[model samples]
Target: MSSAGEAPSELTGAFIEIAKVTDLGATGESETVVGNTTADVSISKDQTNSETNKHSQRRSVRTKTYNTLDIEVPALLVPGASQLETMGVVDSDGEEIYGDVWDACRIHIYDKEPATASSPAQTFEFENVEWDWSEISLPEDYGEISFTGWVHGAWRRGKTATS
Candidate 1:
């Protein structure tokens, strides 16, 4: 009865390893998203001067550049279905996906568990991500992380499939 996105080993402390977009940048097939994890990258600027001098207009700035990879993972995803289709759950011919199918990712993030052939302190490749479970068990708790905005020809860098 192994579930919760089926751990599949390799996850120690702060974690994040996901791959789609045809294994984005290559490295160990990819699919290990653990939590209590937080990683944010930003560079969103292209002028918004003053939101039309807002008193209510509310449009200050931030053209794009977002990776809000945030969530709690000890209970991991709502449960079942290959840990909920590796956090994007229901695809690859399982059907049952709705809204925000943005999919298109490449992430290798680790603040720990890396040494023998290490190099995954950071990497980024994002395209319309949607690791949004939004409600995966709360009689307890768990799950989130998505940020690939601000377009600069889209960022990419992945190659940490150590051994």
Candidate 2:
């Protein structure tokens, strides 16, 4: 809430943490550790609609059809390789590992530095992400080998550390 004379709070792209669930123990709970060499995060929700008309009366219906998240990051040999593998990307051993639909990972994007009392963070727990990018690219002007993936999943978003 803001007073009449005060300007509204604006959210900025800063303080983001992206993690992948690496393990699910016997208790069925997974663990997530922050990813490295990440930049340019994007998330989207898409809906589809269908309409039926009878006797000049129109009935419209809409449903959530797709939820996707994309991120660009420098390629890492260790953790990044494993992360991609979890998303069903192929490994060096010519094996593909996949997670169940119930599996999920956490993504936290903050409006400000975390622990700042004034601004809250948006956390997305994404489930069953299907990887859309498999190849890596190296641009002429860049030193980092960047990789991008389009992930399709169901995500829940909520504010954290709200005032």
Best by lDDT: 2
**Residue 99 local lDDT, model 2:** 26
Error of 1 at 158 (Å): 9.7
Number of backbone clashes in candidate 2: 0
Residue-wise C-alpha lDDT for candidate 1, range 11-74, written one tens digit per residue: 3335555445534334544445422233333323232222234568666653434323322233
Pairs with steric clashes in candidate 1: 5-83, 64-150, 65-149, 65-150, 66-147, 67-147, 69-145, 70-145, 84-89
Question: What is the per-residue lDDT of model 2 for residues 1-163, given as tens digits with 9 covering 90 to 100?
Answer: 1122221122134555555653322344655543432344554333355555566656655554543354444442334454444444445563543322324555565665545735335655555554433454423332334444444544455412212
Please provide TM-scores, in order, for all candidate models, with all chains considered together. 0.24, 0.50
**Which stretch of 10 consecutive residues in model 2 shows the poorest summed lDDT?**
1-10
| Overall local distance difference test of candidate 1 | 0.40
RMSD of each: 16.7, 8.6
